[model samples]
Target chain A: MTQTLDIERELCGHAAVGEAAVTVDGDRVVAFVVPAGGGLSLRELRAELGTEPDEFVVLTALPLAEDGQPDWAELSRSRKDLTRRRMPYTAPRTDTERYLAALWEDLIGVEDIGADDDFFTLGGHSLLAVRIRMRLQRDHGVTVAPEALFENSVLSEQAAVVDRTREA
Target chain B: MSQRTKWLLRDPSPEAEARLFCLPYSGVGASVFRRWPSHIGPLEVCPLQLPGRENRIGQPAYGDFPAFAADAADALADHLDRPYAVFGHCMGSILAHALVTELRSRDVRQPERLFVSSSRVPHWPPDRRYRMPAPGAVGVYHPSMTEEQLADEVSRVSRTVGGTDLHPDLLPLALRVLRSDLEMCFGYAPALAPTGCPISTIGWSDDADVPPAEMGVWQECGPVTHHVLPGDKLTFLEAPAELQEVVEKDFRG
Candidate 1:
């Protein structure tokens, strides 16, 4: 069996779970789960799996794609719901933070990036980071090392890097 | 007629050290490599023409990747006379891996190298994950996309990659092909079966669909050499000199 199927089967085998589909969201393994009539919990699901799942989103029913399979892509996208952010969504307040957030919008394809959002966690990658650097120099006239994006990718953190580098 | 003539849109070069079989991405034909030279250094470019697109417009498309791979491996059986490499972009990258795996099972000649460009690793089925809600933002096409949405994707990609919107007459057929191709991609979720052949994962600098950084997952598949060059997803279409240089160096060493 395929790895994806094996994971899905294991998810179904859980006594507390009704229906579930698994997908990779960037670096995380997210399971979109529909509970059995008895119900289930993220804590229980994680405990059952042994290793902690990155996320377990509870749903009433599994959504199927046109192919009649669980729509994993849509499920993956659903996990990125802003309402459920790990940290509260704080709008970009500083000048550099706002500028970085706008670039994040175009490159990551997400809008209204929060100052607290981690770039990699929010699906930002190397190319996007490089683009961020290029635009930072081009638009804001600040030069940040490539490692800055890797080490400090959050909007506020990155903005600070820009501020420090420009002053230097 | 030999599958050689039927599968390869152009004739193979007898003098080359190896053949580089080029696979097209979704909704198009072998013509995606139209601008590519006949050969890059010693490697001859043999672009494969699948059914239901381009020259084979009336034929039916393959239902899935496995069947396509099986048939392709068989069709190109005669051409496996020499060491060859496989290259694919986006959907073609998945197809490229499938074909390489199929060749291994058949115990036919194996590819010296497999170039998978602009795609996620095959272990998990490819999914369309839009990081945000932005206009003309396509995470990757899926079954549920509306006609209007698909049109926008087609326009945006064509404009971005090919530098012009698809012609009005070609839009309908392109959309049809695009939808079918997207379905095939979402359906495939293969195991991380590493090929005996070395893999070179190619990530485009400006490719928004599959970022260069994300291409690192391919290391799990096998011995892989990753390169993130300057260009977008379709930049390979234009056959950049830097890309050719990489293929030449890889083939030579």
Candidate 2:
């Protein structure tokens, strides 16, 4: 077994955790655990474990292999699909927000971005920011500076900047 | 026609209280600073238009940092009439350091401050090899990286800096510039040296390329002031308020 698997076994020893699986994903150590009591705060759980992981993923149950070990490949897919974004799905509330959200969804290739979801957190890189800038200018008549984009990277914050620019 | 105007992208105001000479990183020219406003506080932003990119596309690029610094010192000598500061990002940081060293060696007036962002100290001990951020299993650049990998890195960095990918027509030249620059960086592993100039090392909160903690090594470079601000490595392009405050504060009389 790997060192990560050992971590998984040790985490199972925690009373707050019903089940746990560990994996190394691209220089990040992610711990997928099922809370014994309906739920447990990540911070409180970390304090219980006595070590910090780069990412903490909560799951209902651990996928298992035929040999009864944790299914590594399935866990990988689950992590990719669900673990990256922590914010709940939130649709845009205002026209400016809706417009900014639309631009971000198209450029960032992610859907259902919440007001607080950071652009960089969604894998939004500089290239995408420039595309959003061009689209805003050409299609929406909104001229946004790259600095504006950098500072106001969240969906609602970006919308506010656009609204301010328009008002001015 | 003067050397000053030839080297600098624009003729900065002589009447200004001070000037900030900005240097571009590898594979690009002064145009990278096009987004920066003309003036911040008393310091005028004067980006150096190095040879081999943009308007100087026809000229051969410098193969070594010392040689580039020597030529720069000569060109910028007479222009240093007012108090000035030097700002460099990434490869430009090392170039900025080298330029300051060159100026000191020539007994020229030094910049009031040196602003280095997203760089490790120039003269790291012989063992620490610096590599480009690339994709895939190896996850870092090596001289053996394929042309495709280098091209991808160029595109990634360009995009990371808030620009789109390179057009097909520009890829060949871009790749050449990238290869040359990477070679220069990888070849550079000088002994740790202190700066005669005051230093301001800026670190970003979200920069994976060079983490903020890694920047503490810069304290050995000189009388140093360190800043940890919100944003990624490329966010410096935005001229964040905290960074501006640091620059203005450092250059303050």
Error of 2 at B223 (Å): 0.8
Candidate 1 runs further than 4 Å off: A1-168, B1-4, B128-140, B161-163
lDDT of 2 by residue, B152-240 (tens): 76677656554456644456766776678768877777666667888998888877667777777888888888888998767877676
Put down candidate 1 lDDT per residue, B1-253, tens digits, no spaces. 2222346664464555789999988887776675565566678788897876654555678879999998899889888999899999888888999999889888788899999888888886555322222443442465677888888777777776655665554577678778888778777777788877888888998776777888888888778888989987678877887888888888776
Candidate 2 positional error at B20, Å: 0.7
Clashes of each: 1, 1
I-RMSD for candidate 2: 16.7
What level of docking quality does candidate 1 show?
incorrect
How far residue B226's Cα lies from its native spot in candidate 1, in Å, is 0.9
- C-alpha lDDT score of every prediction, in listed order: 0.72, 0.71
